[model samples]
Target: MNNLDLQKLLDEMTLEEKIDQLLQLAPAFFEGANSAGQITGPLEGLDLAVENVRRTGSVLGVGGAEEAIHIQEAYLRHNRLNIPLLMMADVVHGYRTIFPVPLAMGSSWDVELVRQAAAIAAKEAAVAGIHVTFSPMADLTRDPRWGRVMESTGEDPWLNGQFARAFVRGYQGEGIANEPYKIAACIKHFAAYGAAEGGRDYNTVDMSEWMRREFYMPSYRAALEEGCEMVMTSFNTVDGIPATGNRRLMRELLRKEWGFDGVLISDWGAVKEMIAHGVAEDEKECALKAIEAGVDIEMMSSCYPHHLQELIASGAVDVQLVNEAVMRILQLKHKLGLFENPHRYADSVAEREILLNEQHLAAAHEAALKSSVLLKNERNVLPLAKDAKVALIGPFATSDDLLGPWSCMGKREEAVTLAAGMLGVADPNTVTAIGCGVEHIPDEELAAMVEAANSAEVVVLALGEDSEMSGEAGCRANIQLPDRQLELVKRVRALGKPLVAVLFNGRPLDLHGVLDEADAVLEAWYPGTRGGAAIAELLYGEANPSGRLTMSFPHSVGQVSVYYNAFNTGRPKDDPNAQVRYVSQYLDIPNEPMLPFGYGLSYSSFRYGEAALSSPLIRAEEKLLLTVTVTNVGERAGSETVQLYVRDIAGETVRPMRELKAFRKIMLEAGETKEIEFEINEPMLRYHHADLSYKSDPGKFEAMVGPNSKEVQALSFELV
Candidate 1:
């Protein structure tokens, strides 16, 4: 419909009709739509009439083309104007052909690959009649205790911002405004939801504005700048105001300063959560605050439909607010071509033909392979010989749970297991396998594992959290390997057998025990469907592992929030001349992460030459050129992630010891060398100052090039 047509419809809509456009619910409230989305609670609490639900503009968490057609048909039958229901779901990783989780995607350091994975997801979901996906979460996570870290791109704001844009491009595909086989992208949990105190999900988030702008806000803005069509407000409060009701954050900043005119949405039940937050007295007040604060749609809640009309009639809010929100909602619907054909996405033929095809599965396998980070390879223990007798033992050894959590539409039975992958790649006579539960390793299970190891030349212990243990609401106070698993690792280490620990976890794990006991460690994060095949390929030398760590592995649970980029303290532990007694070093352990960010091992070794700079001073208009020659000194061909980090020697406020400004993942042949160049511009050097103003202070800066954050060769330059 044209703008005039949409406006006329808005003018004709009754107060109930207008509120219906702002209401979003699961399938239970609407007839014929199945339970594809989670139900927050019963619909009885909503007190919404059946007619109101029938007229609701959108449906959440409902999947399948047939189901979608049924929903749209049911709604149109009851509606006076024949409006179609917009279908949205939490298609975070994949709809049917699952890919690696977002954190795993970050480890690949390949934006194009990540984009392709998202595009594949969109294609699969679109055929199933999905129109919008709450995806590419874009939250910069520092703590692994939060289970939702699986949905994020990981620690660094710069990298998260890059992945955010990639997800947006992949999902919205060169402007989804009119594109088919695509869906609108929603960059979610706006404004620092990942910084929840103590790493608890939905917990209080208290942070300085300087820290928020400098570290947490970049990715959200980046996704928005990439034309992300929707924004989902975070659950926690920001600056003493819930983001859903904060006029300063949503209106003054997001809308006025950032110019985000796209549809803004509240996370599931976040609107009524204001009462739990003690910010709103009742539902009426909550409706008033959210609309005024710029929320266009309320998800899984009755705040808008139940109380909006009363609030409007009471003059607590202007009717123009509701009109603007309805217009935005209608505009998005029109953009999706909903008015043109309510059943545009309901294509059962395409659904049966396009989903989980061989091509899509191959791409998923490729993504899973690249996303697996080889965290440790001691004494060249990895790349196991295909002829050597290998023992695979763990709960995941034969289980198809490799699809991981939030794999909304992937079928578990279709997933390949380690045993199947081994049989496919290795000599059947050389592979022995047994299923030992991840936790509660009984005497019988241990004896069985010992027998399997005794008959094999080497052991590959597949262990990590289950799919149920590390996604939404999967937070853990102790981010370590399960006690039974650690004990089993110790016992296996005592057996004097060569060991390789293949981990399948969602978040960064405290691998202290596994690292000490195992000869090799591979973090195959909830790798989707082809995960088993990818792991087999890497283990058999068919694929070289190059994935890097996007999140730091903590030395201990006490180091929960440790990340690579941190403010330099006055009593810095890195000061070589400082005495140990007065330095900022831990007494029991070193002031370092167990596995530092940007760290990953490969079958090949990489050597970096001294950094070369074009000039010592950088002008405002010109970018400084820095080059480093990287060589694959190992015998095998492999890929390496050459990272470039910078440190601001001086600023108005203290600066992080080192910040990741740029990186390039390069593929090289044996003994091949390549000169990688990076351009350092003004924006790269700027940070939020004491007053929250972004600028680069005139001072000497250190540019470092290396394989990871901990070790690097430094070169000094001045930003003048």
Candidate 2:
């Protein structure tokens, strides 16, 4: 059906029905919903009647294919027009076959792998009858204190933008209209939600227009360019106004300037929270502001349903606003072919076969393997011999909490633990012990671990924050391992056994204690369902570690927002002429982070040859080629992520010290050497000036090529 059909359906609806279509509620609110009694507080708190739920525009979540079918069938029976409910869920990383967290996927630096992971997530969710996934959270975060950093790709706008486009393509493969197994992708937390002050969740974001556009807005734009189906407003405020009700941001900028005609949604309860943000007077004012700002759906909020009709009748809101929102909803349904078959892809039989299938699990395993960053490997201590008597001791030794937050339908019980993975390769004498919990260690547990360490040839300490420690609202001030866990590490170190540490976490942590104590450290970021298996492969040399750090790991929490792409101050710390006491330097810690972005290690060592430029200078539209030879100098084959970064000597405004413009991940044999060439055009050197106009200025530039950001070979060039 076209706009005419949607418009006719809108015309047939009474004011009450049209208003109902603007609200999104949980599945439990529907009488025949799978979890009808799953949640009682939300239903009573919102004061929404059963009838209002039946006519609701969308369902927040569904249990499975059976539940989605039941909710739609029940809702359709009560509707005069038989308009189906849009099934939406927060399928962040995975639906059932869980993969690595978004931050981990970013570390892989493999867009195709990230894309494949998303497609698998879409396939699983779509079969369970989920129409839309709140995924590819494109917030470029610098602060690790924000718990939601796990959801974002990283601190680089360019890399985050690349992942955003990949996710959209993966989730909405081809198009939902043609692809029945794909779900619609929603790029979320629009307008710099990741830059919350103090790195606190739901805190105010006060940034200049230039910074927001230059650093934060690129990812959202890239996702829209890829035709993402929807946009979700953040819970924070922009320029002292809440994003859910900011007219200039939603209507003027996103809808008018960018020309995005897709559905606009509010992050949970964000519409009503505008009253708390001191902008709206009450529910009536909240509804008026939200609709005026072009928010099509208010998730888990009663502001629209309770006050929209009254506001429309009082002439405070135009009826056309409601009509447009309803049309967009209908258009989405039409795209998913829901109007023709409301129960599209809700196949119970097929869902069982597709969810957590062998192929999907293999993809998850590969993702975990590539996403795990080898932070420190001393004296070739890793790639432990399979016949060694290993002692795996820590909270996560046998724990099944491998699947991280927002793992919609993934089961922890199904996760392969570290102990289970070690059993497959190690000697029969290998011992396993949970020496401590995330924040505590018992006396008996410590004793068991010590005894195991005494009898073992090697000790592998598996530790990190629990699944509850780092997702939404999982902020930490210290951003370090708990005191008890650190104590456990010290005890294991005293045993004089070869020690290795594996971290299961979401955010980039301060590795002061653990890094010094462990002989080798692997950042196995909350690896999903197959985390244990993949980690085992990396430890046993079955697979080489290739994942890099997308976000920098701070030396201390004092450097909460440290990143590679930062402007150099006038009295730079690295300047030889500048006095050490007078330069912009920290008294206690170094200016640099413990680990820099695009930094990772592999079992196989890599050697970089001097970079050569095809030309010393080039004009506009001319291409400059910088070629470098990379060789694997070790005994084993491995993949290396070659990063290309550029620095502007002078700009209309001071630019970052190094900005990642392009990157390529290539595999090399034990003794193979490959020449990698990058084509640099004029457009690649452009940046936003002080006046906020995006253009490249004629200037001297430096091109750097290396395995990571810090260690690189540079060549000078002039763009005139």
Candidate 3:
């Protein structure tokens, strides 16, 4: 619909209808809604009649094309204005052919692969009649205690921003002007929801404006820049005010300043829950504040319908706020071409054809292969010989729960198991197995399992958090492997056999307990649908491991929030000539992360040549060319991600020790040397200053080019 038609429809809406349009609900609100995606029963109170639901502009947490059609037909049947209900869902990773969780995808360090995965998710979700997906969660987090880290693409703002843009472009493929399989992307939890105090879910966040802009807001900016059509308000407070009701954040900064006119949504029940947050006295005030703050849609609650009309009558609120919100909602609907055809995406034939199609499944398989990071490989025990007898032991050995949390559309039964994958590559008879469980087993049972591993030439010990133990509401104080799993590692170590530990988890786990025992460790974070096949291939040298860590794996839970790019403290962790007492060192453990960000190993070794610079000095306007030669030293073809890092030697404000500025992923054959060059420009050096201005500080700067953050060669340059 055009602007004229949208305005006419908005003008025609009654106060009650307008308020209802702002409300989003599940299928239970509709009379004949299916149970496929229903999170809860119909919410009680104000207006949930079938007619009210018909006018309710949007529905979420409902599954399938036929069900969406059922609900949309019901809504359109009773409508005088013929407005269709907008369908939305959290297609977080995949709709059917689930790829690895976003965290694992981030590990791949391949933006194009991430985009392709999102495109696949969009295609599958679009066929199911979903108009919007709340995905590419751009929350910058550090603490592993945040269970939702599985949803985020890890801790770096720069990396997250890159992934955020890729996801937006993939989901909104050439905009709404395109066909099915492309939908609007929603960059969620608007500001610093990940930096919740102590990393607890839904906890408060107290961030300084400088810290907020410097570290947390970049990914959101990247999303909006990529044309993300919606923004979801976070549950946490920014400064003292909850982001859902903070005008300065939602309106002044997001809408006016950043120029985002897209629809703004509240995380499920975030609006009314603001009362519990002590920011509002009641639901009325919560609704008033959220609407005034420019939240166009109240998801999963009755706040607006419960109080908007009364507030309008009592002169506590203006109806214009409601109209503007509704207009934004209508714009989304129009852009989606919903006005032209509400049932466009609801096609059962297309849904049958697209879900888990061969190409999508293959992409998922490749993604899983690249996402498995080789955390530790001692004595070169990895890249198992094709003829080697394999014993795959673990509770996950045959289980298909590889589909991690947030995989709503993916059926676990369809997931390929490790046992199945091993059988697919080689003879099933050559692969022995035992019950490898995350939880504890009886001593006798454990002994029997160990006996099975003893017969194989090499053992593949599958372990890590249960699927339910590492997602939303799945926070763990102890991120180490479970007690039984830890004990199993020790037992396997006593056998003095070559072993590989395949970890299926969401967050960066503290691997200290089991690290020393395992000969090789692969962080295969909840590697979705094709997880089994990918791991099997990596083991047999079919695919070389190339994925890197996006989030730093802490040496211990005590160091929960660890990352490569950290501010230089007043004192360093260890001064070679000084006593340890004065420095910011941890007495018990080293201050360094166990596995630093951008750290990964491939089967083939890579050697980085000292970086060569075009010039040591350069004007602000002119660019400096930084070049480095990366050679594959090992006797195999492989992929390497060459990272570019920078440090502000001196600046107007404090700076991180090293910041990732750019990276390039390239493939090389044995003994092949490739030259990689990156343009160093003024924009790359800019940051949010003490006064909130974004600009580059003219000063001496250092750049490093290498395989990862920790291992690099540096060169100095001047930006004058």
The model with the greatest lDDT is: 2
lDDT (tens digit, per residue) of candidate 2 on 389-472: 888888888888899878889999988888888787566456454545778788788888888888888899999989888888
Q: What TM-score would each prediction reach against the true structure?
A: 0.98, 0.98, 0.98
Query: Which of the predicted structures, 2 or 3, would earn the higher lDDT when compared with the native?
Result: 2
Please identify model 1 stretches exceeding 4 Å from their true place: 40-44, 576-579
lDDT of each: 0.88, 0.90, 0.87
lDDT assessment of candidate 1: 0.88
Model 1 over residues 142-204: C-alpha lDDT tens digits?
989999999998999999999999999999998876677889999989879999888887788
lDDT by residue (1-720, candidate 3, tens digit) is: 689988988888888889889988877777557864635233555455666677787888667888888888878888778888888888988998999999999999999999999999998888889999988799997999889999999888999999999999889987965755689999988999999988788889997999999999999999999999999999999879999999999999999999999999998888888888999998899999998999999988788988899999999999999999999999999899888998767788899999999999999999999999998889899988767888888767777889899996899988988788877887777888676567766788678768878888888898888888877778888888888778777887788889988888999988976677899998889999999999888977888999999999999989878888898787886557666698887889888989999999889999988789999987878999999999999999999999999999987889999999999999999999999999989999999888999999878999998888999899999988
lDDT agreement of model 3 with the native: 0.87
**Model 2 worst lDDT run, 10 consecutive residues:** 36-45
Q: In model 1, where is the ten-residue run with the lowest total lDDT?
A: 35-44
